[model samples]
Target: MLTVMGATGNTGKKVVELLLAAGQQVRALGRSEPRLGALAAQGAEVLAGDPGDAAFLTRAFRGASAVYVMLPADRESPDYHEAQRAKGEAIIQALRESGVRHVVALSSLGADQPEGTGLLVTLHAQEERLKALENTNILLLRPASFFENFLDALPIIQHQGINADAVEPDHAIPMIASRDIAEVAARALVQRDWSGIVVRELLGQRDLSYREATRIFGARLGRPELDYVQLPPEEMRQAMVQAGMSETFAGLYVQMTQAFNEDRVQPRAGRTADNTTPTRFEDFVAGLALDSANP
Candidate 1:
């Protein structure tokens, strides 16, 4: 059986669906009863528990041939780094105790550095902790910043007809769709081809700047003159905090944007066929626009 953590999340739910369609036994883990029941209805064994609980996770991991480990993003956490560390340590213990042989950890780009990569610092530590698993083979999927992140801007766009973020507008950043990340992760979980610890950077089709992206989104949404605004880091942080993000995570997010603009946080590896995932922003935005129009 394959156990999937964060099964109620975007990528994790896709992972469960893919595994189930492949006729694999899937155990989906999450804390929400409604979501878990939905997965149960979809042919997965649902285990509802806190992923940060070592004992619960150990039980969930037991007898699994492979496990997808995704540490869900917590914008409201009082201490995001400590939360990441605590969850990482718990998963490590669960992996060790359950002897789960294969793991696919959902990591991000710039996870190799000890500092400077704001939100990714904890991911670096998690990678190290997973590497210490002597008997387990692990795959670290370090995907680029997600395109789904852009959805947060939709409301702002509707209100102001502008796309605003801390990300540098002129910088051609590597952005990927969550579906592509889920596809690669599912393939890795199914194939189980690698041994030891492996890191794969999942860069979407090509690099795209927010300037280029805003134009495309504008065109798609019938707003040809929509503008991309790169808010000042402090302004962005304040906006996010006012929008319900904890001040701590908002600061970390601003730091990450600073790192991005400074070129500190980037993929250390070049793009390869296996690492370059399909799903261009244009195609993704087309679907997103259609969904929004219908909904």
Candidate 2:
């Protein structure tokens, strides 16, 4: 049996669906019952509770052969980093007690760095905590910036005719579709032959600058000259706050963009046999456009 945390989320939902389609037993855990009902209907054992709850995690993870884990950020938390650390500690403790043989952790590209990655520092701490577990196979799927993240910009783009970020328009960065991350996670979970802590980086097809990405998006939307603009840090913070993020969370987001713009987070070039995900930016954009039009 495979237990998936954050099962209602984008990547976790895909992982649950893929596992179910393959006739594998899946326990899907999330904080909401209504959201998990669809997955339950599709042959998943739905567990409704917070993954950070140790009792809930123990119940959800018991008897599972492998597990997929991720510590999702809570924008409303007064101390986001502490919340993440507490949650990560809980998962590690639960995993150690449950005797689960393997874990596929959803981390980011810059999680290896101890500083400067802001929110990703939590994932770095998670990796360190998980590394101390003996006789457990841990797979760290470190994906670059998600193409799905751009979906959050759709409202501004549609209304203002521009995409905004703190990063420069000309700065190229690797972006992967969430589906690719899910695919890699599912593949890793099923392969019980592999053991030890393995780190894999998922880069979609190529790295493209925000300017280039805007051009592609414009072409697909039938707008030829849609562009990306770099907002000042304060402007970025205000925008995030207006979007309902807390001031602290907004500041951290701005810090992340600063790191990206300054090229502090560069894409790693190592190729692993397990890192062969092939979703292109054009394909991802087309799907997002369709989802937006329908929604």
TM-score per candidate, chains pooled: 0.95, 0.94
lDDT of all predictions, in order shown?
Answer: 0.89, 0.85
Across 233-295, the per-residue lDDT of candidate 1 in tens digits comes to: 999999989989988899999999898999887888777787788899999988874554421
TM-score, cand. 1: 0.95
Could you report the Cα RMSD, in angstroms, for every candidate shown? Answer: 1.6, 1.9
lDDT of 2 at 97: 82
Model 2 lDDT on a 0 to 1 scale: 0.85
In model 1, how large is the Cα lDDT of residue 164? Answer: 95
Off by over 4 Å in 2: 270-276, 289-295
Quote model 2's TM-score: 0.94
Q: What is the C-alpha RMSD, rounded to one decimal, of candidate 1?
A: 1.6
Worst 10 residues of 2 by lDDT: 286-295
Clashes (N, CA, C under 3 Å) per candidate: 0, 0
